[model samples]
Target: MSVLVVGASAAGLTTAEALRRKGFRDPITVLGAEYHRPYDRPPLSKQFLLGDWDETRTRLRPDTMLTALDAEFVLGDPAVALDGHTVHTTSGRSLTADHVVIATGLTPRRLPGPDLEGVHVLRTLDDAAALRRSLTPEVQVVVVGDGVLGAEIAATVCKLGLSVTLAGPQAALMEAQLGAVVGGLLGELHTAAGVELRLGVAVDGLTGVGGRVSGVRLANGDLLPADVVVVALGAAPATGWLEGSGLTVENGVVCDEYCRAADGVYAAGDVARWRAEDRLVRLENRTNATEQALCVAANILGERQPYRPIPYFWTDQFSTRLQVHGRPSADLTIAEGNIGERFVAHYRDAGRIVGVLGWNAPKQTRAHRQHLVRT
Candidate 1:
């Protein structure tokens, strides 16, 4: 059985590797929209932005290693359409396979303003490279959004001898992921790093001088001066291209608990929304990418296994490594550990462990996740 995987990022590449491990000898093809080799994205805003990596170090796999897998790599050609069992590429190529996996991931959300030269987003290697070239001590970088990506960018820019101003609608950094308590700690950390944070303030619009971002206007009649603006406004699943594909698309391409999609198609990573009991969950995490890909690979090779993975996520900011296990929603009661050298937080729903967070405490959080009662 032939397998055609669209997207060669973490989820798609992991799916192909898992398929090989399962001994699927049929022709396996991995298609990528980017011209460069598949690489890890989590480091794009951190180590990569800080110039700790070189071009040769950015690739996920060397040409020799990928060739050894016997998987055909179609670079720079994105799958444009899915007509039944056939995959149509943007480069006028068609590949027919018994199974198709959609792992298109997400695209960075653009802001409403004049097209500015210094405004950027950190999603791809090109984005990181552009931002890296402009990182100087004289540059005053303003980052939109207080999510993990924005926070990381703010932290890294500060380390690079650049002044960074973080703007977000949330009251604290990582409020949605780490809850209010840990988020408060993050706010202090950013402040300690000399990051000028403008939280709970929405940007009215961006001010540009000669098609370059100069400052951002706030709704409260405040204009924060900036030479460089990084729009880290989160990501939406890259499902717009699949609008007429007949697959359910809410926040992402909806898949079953087994990662099985419509017809002979499947989805994984940030682009996949799976049914987890009563809720349709889409976890945008690397852990989810690898585990769900393995599940998809197993089902593709005729193994009837389900993808019931506990949602886990991690974020590295400065000296802290915050790890999350399970879902954190409105229904859960958040219980946080006292702020100390190391942080640990737990989310309990109806007295059952539903989620846990640990800073530099992976083993503790892993053990805590084991005690979680899946409803």
Candidate 2:
């Protein structure tokens, strides 16, 4: 049997690696839209953007290990359409296999604005490279989102001694995800680090002068001046290529509990919306990319196990490293430490612990991870 994986990023690469580890000697092919070798994206905004890590440091695996897998790597050609087990690429090439896996990941969302210079988005290696070149202490930078990516960019830019203003509709950074309690603390951290917080205000539009970004226009009719603007407005699953492929697409490619879209087709990573208990859940994070890929690989080998996992996510901003375990969406309460220093916060829903989080305290927070009642 042969397998065709439609993405060559972390998720796709991990799936192929897992297959090889499980003793699947079948011929495997990994296809990618980008020409770059499989690279880790989590560093793109931190170490890479800060120029602390080189291109070789960001690669997920070196040439030696990838060669050991013995999988065909077809780069730069994007898959455009799918007909059953057959995938057609833009270069007029078609590949069919006994099984197909979709791990295409996400595309950064952009606001309706002019194609002005100095405005950026950080998703791909190219995006990170362009934004890195445009960043300096000379420019007034405005990050137009309070989400994870936007917050990271703001932190990284501010660390470089550049003027950064984080503008978003949320009252605090990551409010929608971690709740107000933790969000408030995060806001304090950014403020302490000299990042101008323009929260609870929606961005009206972008102002450009002579085809370059001049400032960001707020919904309240105020303009924050800037020479560079980075739009960190979340992302959507990259499933546009799966259109007309007779697959269910709602937020992401809908799949069964086993992550199988059809008899011989499966999906992993951000592109997959699979059934988890009573709800359809789609996770978009680095940990899920590796974990879910292993699950999919097991099922592809006929293990037939479901992909139910306790969600995990983390982010670093300035001097703080926040770690989250399970779904931290309910009422947040401090389990240890305080807001002024390292602490552990737990989320409770109906008087039962659902999630746990740590701020600058990795070991303590990891100890409290057991409080999260797994579903």
lDDT of each: 0.85, 0.93
lDDT per residue for candidate 2 within 1-375, as digits (tens), equals 999999999899999999999999999999999999999999999999999988899999999999999999999999999999999999999999999999999998887967999899999999999999898668899999999999999999999999999999999889999998888889999999999999999999999999988999999998999999999999999999999999999999999999999999999998999998898999999999999999999999999989988888899999899999988875988899987799998898888888999999999988998877544
Candidate 1: Cα lDDT at 84: 80
Error of 1 at 175 (Å): 1.1
Clashing pairs in 1: none
TM-scores, all candidates, are 0.96, 0.99
lDDT of 1 by residue, 1-375 (tens): 899999998999999999888777889999999998889888898899999987668788888878878999899988888888788888899988999999999999989866889989989999999999988779888998899999999998988878889998898898887677777888998898899999998878899888888898888999999898999989999987686778888999988877888868999998999887877888888888888888889888878777788778888887778888887643433344446567566776676677888877777767677766543
Clashing pairs in 2: none
